[model samples]
Target: MNTKTPAGTEQITVSNITIDIVRKDIKNIHLAVYPPMGRVRIAAPFLVKDDAIRLFAISKLSWIRRQQRQFAGQERLPPREYKERESHYYQGKRYLLHIVEAEGWPKVILKNKTWIELYVRPGTTLEKRHALMTRWYRTQLKKQIPALIEKWEQIMDVQVNGWQVRQMKTRWGSCNPDQKKIRLNLELVKKPASCLEYIIVHEMVHLLERHHNEVFLAYMDRFLPHWRQLKAELNKLPVRHEEWGY
Candidate 1:
């Protein structure tokens, strides 16, 4: 039986690798390696013993090191300043930002397939500009998401009660299996459409199998045969600069 204890966080070292451990009222141990630094964390059931967790960590030492190395070598974009001529991505294409000062209503548009025209009032502050761009990204992502959800629902025979877009720092997407709801990271708008579909399918698959265990992987493989390739492509894309917190 799973313990209903409140979550607690602590750390342990195995073979010189520090692993963050969080004990929660969960059924199975969930291990994850987060990006931008490949920080390793394990969310285990409260009843699981520390010795077991340490053994698990020791077994995954090589995988942890590989993930850390991948993160260390991945390309990262510099901080966005929302200024003219700055490079930005949309649908896997790079375009220069073209700032246009206008009288009313800030809007974003694409011009000649080479520029992202961001129209704002004169002397707009950096924060406002960033917010405007984020809203635009959100709008664009929302437009594309429903169609993908509809497509996957029929194919996977799953019902998504609801979906939302959020600016997440650590995860690409997450799902509430019991609620049949999924939340996608707003940053996905900047990636290729295939990547977006991949994330949607991944989250939707969680509705069939809650944990990332063997059954979950089998479902993923059956539903999306080329999922591994898409996952690699998504991970290789340049991520935006942000102050990440554990």
Candidate 2:
């Protein structure tokens, strides 16, 4: 079996398009088009040369451009200071943030799904307020995962050992077939519910097929025929505001 080790990171330019190449002890090179922006990443076996990786990226230039164009049209969330009256998204819907100060720990409540009431102690630091918001987001995302996992497990006839919600910079979700584990981006909670469901199903499908190869595509098509539409819709929404290393 191939050994597991920390992956190496490198930057390469192919036809004026930059690609981040991650070197891992794997059998084949896997290319991923990430969202918020279509940053391309290639996970390749350690023996592969930078030149070979460049050539591979060059070969997929058209597909890369298409994915980038898609991201270019999507809306982008601006840097948030967690102030009152600011816009926030949950499950694909928009809500105005309403902050109320009290002498206790912070809390978040949805006001009729149209507004988010953030209760924070007076004189709370900006970082603390942001943390409260992030914690709320994590809780919301976590609540949605179980039902989706159970539903997909039945449909896909596969069971994941566990799944987690986390702050992810690159992909929305990933699955490790060996460990039967799945991880989803916590930022996904800000998007539409359909988008979140799409990601959950997408990762679950990975249990059946590891690579985003034709077989994987076929499985996605067979199980979630509307996956392409859902993916497009998800990509069309505003990506979370983060300082991404591209």
Candidate 3:
């Protein structure tokens, strides 16, 4: 926790504890406890009073402790830079990157059924290389989305009106039951195919159960028993480096 008092809100600190009060574009105060350690965070609307926020945190102390414990057991991957011999996951398979330089635009191709074709200059900066690779990933996801939607529609008996992929900063996927649409993070293409399938199934189940209550978990377990493992692995993997919103 890092306490910072912005212009609108006030900050408070207690020993190792730090709290930041800032304005946000939301209706409620959201408190979070992140992993690898029991770091606490609170986000309150600009108009929320300091006393009210303090009371909320005090009331949720037990819940926050439980969240910290969950995070403590979860694994976190180190930061990555697009470098030679770097490992990447695709559809539950790990592939070593083989960078090759060419005269034309960069292109990726599978090589020897063991490695990946990442056509880029050796001198290319990690950021640019990552961008190009991410773009290709989005393309691959686009090619697969339609078939996946159809495959799942029959298996889960749920119809999707539309689906789209984007560079989401935080969550892997989101579902809108009213519109029968699901938006998936393009980064999911980098993970195992089973992970994507789990997400698809998870979102589709939301069509029947709107919230993550007992019914939702039961439906998920009935449809995808190994979903919990996939979710745990997904959380351990490195995510895109971008600002996230709750």
Q: State in Å the error of residue 25, model 2.
A: 13
**Local accuracy of candidate 2 as per-residue lDDT tens digits, 1-246:** 122225544677777776777776576788877676677888888898767777788889999998888777767788788897999989888999999999876799998878899999898889988999999999988998899889989999999899988888866888899999999998889888888888888888879988666678789899889998998777677766762322
lDDT of 3 at 97: 84
Model 3: CA > 4 A from native = 1-80, 121-127, 238-246
Estimate the TM-score for candidate 2: 0.78
Q: lDDT tens digits, residues 1-246, model 1? A: 112225454888777776888876676788777667677889898799988888888888889999889878888899899998999999888999999998999989988789999999999999999999999999999999999999999999999999999989878899999999999999899999999999999999999988776678789999999998998788777777763322
lDDT (Cα atoms) of all candidates against the true structure: 0.86, 0.82, 0.72
TM-score of each: 0.83, 0.78, 0.66
Q: List the residue pairs that clash in candidate 1.
A: none
Greater TM-score among 1 and 3 belongs to 1
- List the candidate numbers ranked by lDDT, top first: 1, 2, 3
Tell me the lDDT of candidate 1.
0.86
Candidate with top lDDT is 1
How many backbone clashes are present in model 1? 0
Listed per model in order, the count of residue pairs whose N, CA or C atoms clash below 3 Å is: 0, 2, 3
lDDT of 3 by residue, 1-246 (tens): 324455544565544345555556556777665444555677677687777887777777778777667765654444567666777766656788888876667777767657887888557778878788878788888887788778978887889998889778666789999999999988789777777888888888988887655678789999889898987676555443443322
